[model samples]
Target: MNKAALILALVAAPALAEPDAHALERLVKQDCGSCHGLTLKGGLGPDIRAQALAHYEAAALQAVILDGVPGTPMPPWRPLLTDEEAAWIAEYLLDGDRE
Candidate 1:
């Protein structure tokens, strides 16, 4: 391929850095797996997959992560997780669904 074509291809290529599932899993396991399953199917907590985070807006996801669901085993993580970390977890699950 020509130098110009190679350069264009490199530029147009999709982002190669997809989020890491293992790292996400580790975070979920450490933070959520005690209640939710290690795989995020279910445990003491309700099935997060069934909840379908894809349906939720980023704001809604943030609310749940930060404030936690009421009348459930899910507990508010405001003190435990910074807003940025919570947002990352929410986006990871909503966008990646590594489980």
Candidate 2:
């Protein structure tokens, strides 16, 4: 391949790669679970069950997941997650399919 093509391929590799579900789940179960409870029922943080999140918009929740609540233990995860990953986690939380 040409030099420019190789550089382009390298730049696009991450964007083209599939997201790792196990990693995402682990993040939720370990990192998020630390505060939200292993089952996400509630702990240091409020309950994140689907029913409890019924009133919250997915975008709003995604914002919280990425930016976190100021002055709270919820630290922003933007440094650790992409916006798409944050949105996925928000959807997962609202789906109530913890496992």
User: How large is the C-alpha RMSD of every model relative to the true structure?
Assistant: 11.0, 4.6
Model 1: per-residue Cα lDDT at residue 37 = 77
Q: On residues 1-99, what C-alpha lDDT tens digit does candidate 2 reach at each position?
A: 899999998998797466567789899989998998988889999888899999989999999999999999999999988788888888888888645
The sequence of per-residue lDDT tens digits that candidate 1 reaches over residues 1-99 is 899999986885554234454665587877787787776777888666635556888778878988988897788988766666677778777765344
In Å, residue 46's CA in model 1 sits off its true spot by: 2.0
Off by over 4 Å in 1: 1-25, 97-99
Measured with C-alpha atoms, the lDDT of residue 72 in candidate 2 is: 94
Best model per lDDT: 2
Each candidate's number of clashing pairs is 0, 0
- Each model's lDDT comes to 0.71, 0.88
What is candidate 2's CA lDDT for residue 46?
86
